[model samples]
Target: MDQKTILVAFGGASPEHEVSVITSHQAIAALQESNYSITPLYLTKNGRWLTGETLLDLKNFEDLKKLEDSCTPCTFGQNEFGQPVLLEQKTGFFSKPKTTPIFAVIDGFHGSKGENGAFQGACEMFNIPCTGSGVMGSAIGMDKVMAKTICRANEIPVAESVDFFEPDWVDHQSTLITKIESLEYPVIVKPVHLGSSIGVEVVMNQESLIRAVEAAFKYDDHLLVETVITPLMEINCSVLGSSRAQRTSVCERPIGKEELLSFQDKYLNDAEAKGMASADREIPAKIPDELTKAIQETSVKVFKLLSCSGLARLDFLVNEETHQFYFNEINTIPGSFSFYLWKESGISFTDLLLELIDIAVEDQNQKARRIQSYDTNLLSQKAVKGIKGLKSKK
Candidate 1:
């Protein structure tokens, strides 16, 4: 069999772009060249798509201007036969277009358009297999309010939250504040669709609540306000596999030095402290056996409920005083692909990457079995009466 070509796409138009870059580099390094060919696709902050040898080097990213100049910008679109093609400059005077079979796409994108299902929809249109959740799952998981709604429907324990649109908050400030005040103090205010703890504020008072809401609105049109769980211990578990079969990795207790896991504490500070050596975590979190089992089970349920495939990390906040656990959020495209957690389960990073690719191919094949089009053309049989005959006679 011919070696499958996998596109390790990263550095999307999201706040987590730099983190995605590091993730893609790690994946590219772990991929086995014998069974698959790796192509690095970089999505610039300005939304330009580029692919070239320069993207593979992590050092190139340090100098953004130079890296952008070195990479050849490209565009992706379907060809005459409905095959995906990449159009780029081949030479100084001539342009070259190439159409390579993308066996699978490993999405290292974290948030925004990339993680919010836009990229997934594009990949689906091109009939390319992609790792992680599909359109519905990605969109739902990215939006905190939507995820909470789904969890509530599924009887999953989630922190009580109130969602408000920016327009409503701006127009009816007093009403919104009254509604928010119904919940106790020390609430968490989050943007509807962001990750890496960006625009997440823990408000301990009414003044902070108002300020947090204002800050959150700047990041997204919708905001989620939830009562903070006192004496909170953050626990995270990685769930892997498709809807049919899934497994939960050993739980990790994330310890942060602040009131909440701030953006800097989660990524920037950790990166500066560890230099990619290891992420700060406590593997197999020090918790009771029953509590561990419950968290693991809930993690698997959330993964399947969200229709997520490939991999995802489910975060939870456990109240130390009450011993209550509440689902925090889900990361469809978790940082570093949650390789460390899987590694604890005896899966190497290289093996995990290969497994994800295999899952993507299998999922794509399964989807192909469904019938997408009808043999008859309904438009041809339609009349121009414009619902004249559709009126019901009472």
Candidate 2:
């Protein structure tokens, strides 16, 4: 059989764009020796989709202007065989667009539309397999309030939070502040639609809370203030497979340099920007066996509960002394694919990628097996005649 084309899709209009690029590059490198041909689908920060051989090289990204000028613009389309393809739009006096059949897409995005179901929805529209969660799962995973509300309803522990849109804040700042302050002091303010702690801030006083909220508004219009878990120790567990069947990897305890894991703390530790693998963390976290087991079990529960497929990393906030934990959030397309945790679980990076691809293919196959559309011709001559009669009557 011929080698399949795996489109490594990444980058988006989000604060975590660089982190997404790093994750995609890491995935590309791991899949280099696999039985598949890799294609780069680099979505620029300004929202242009471009792809080329140059995009496959990380060095080319050093000067984005030069890189953008050299890459070919591309879009999704159907080929002669009606197969989904990545059609390259070449600009020239005598140039024809080239189409490459896309067997599947490796979604390595971290935030914004790329990870919030928009890109996944596009793939669904084209009837192609895309790795990671589907539209509903991705949307819920990216929304902090919705995810937490679902968890809370499922008897899963979650911190109390008050969410408000920009307009709500503009019109009812005092009322919102009163509601948030009810969660008590030292609450954490976060942008609802972002991940990687891009706009997360731990606040104490009302003055500091207002300042943080104003600052976070720059990143997102939807904001939430949640009760902070004091003496917090963050634990994250990765779940693989789908709702039908799945397993959780060994839990990891991330070591933040400050109060909470900030964007810089997660992605800026290494000079080479080695993605989440370079972040400070303790694998198979030294927590009690019971705590670890609880986290692992809860991770799988949340994954299946949210209808997540392929893989997801669920983070939990723990009260170090009490050993109590609360589900924080789920990252559908986790940074570095949460491969570091999986690595410690005895699964290699390449194997993890392969497993994700297999899950996506299985999902697509399952969908194909179902009735996609009605076979009858609704626009038959008889139906047309009836329509003509209605028009004649009118």
Model 2 TM-score relative to the real fold: 0.96
Local accuracy of candidate 2 as per-residue lDDT tens digits, 1-394: 8789999999989899999999999999999999999999999999999999999999888999999999999999999899999999967879888999999999999899999999999999998999999999999999989889889989999988899999999999999999999999999999999998988899989999999999999999999899999899999999999867999999999998885997787888888859998889988799999999999899988998888999999999999999999999999999999999889989999999999999998998888999988878769999999999999997
Q: After superposition, how far is residue 30 of candidate 1 from its true place, in Å?
A: 1.3
Worst ten-residue run, lDDT, model 1? 270-279
What lDDT does each candidate get?
0.84, 0.93
lDDT of 2: 0.93
What is candidate 1's lDDT per residue for 4-105, written digit by digit as tens? 678888887777788778777888888855488888888999998888888888888999889989888776666677766555646555645665666788
- Tell me the TM-score of model 1: 0.91
| Candidate whose TM-score is highest | 2
Best by lDDT: 2
Error of 1 at 24 (Å): 1.4
Give per-model CA RMSD. Answer: 3.5, 1.7
Q: Which runs in model 2 stand beyond 4 Å of their true positions?
A: 91-94, 376-394
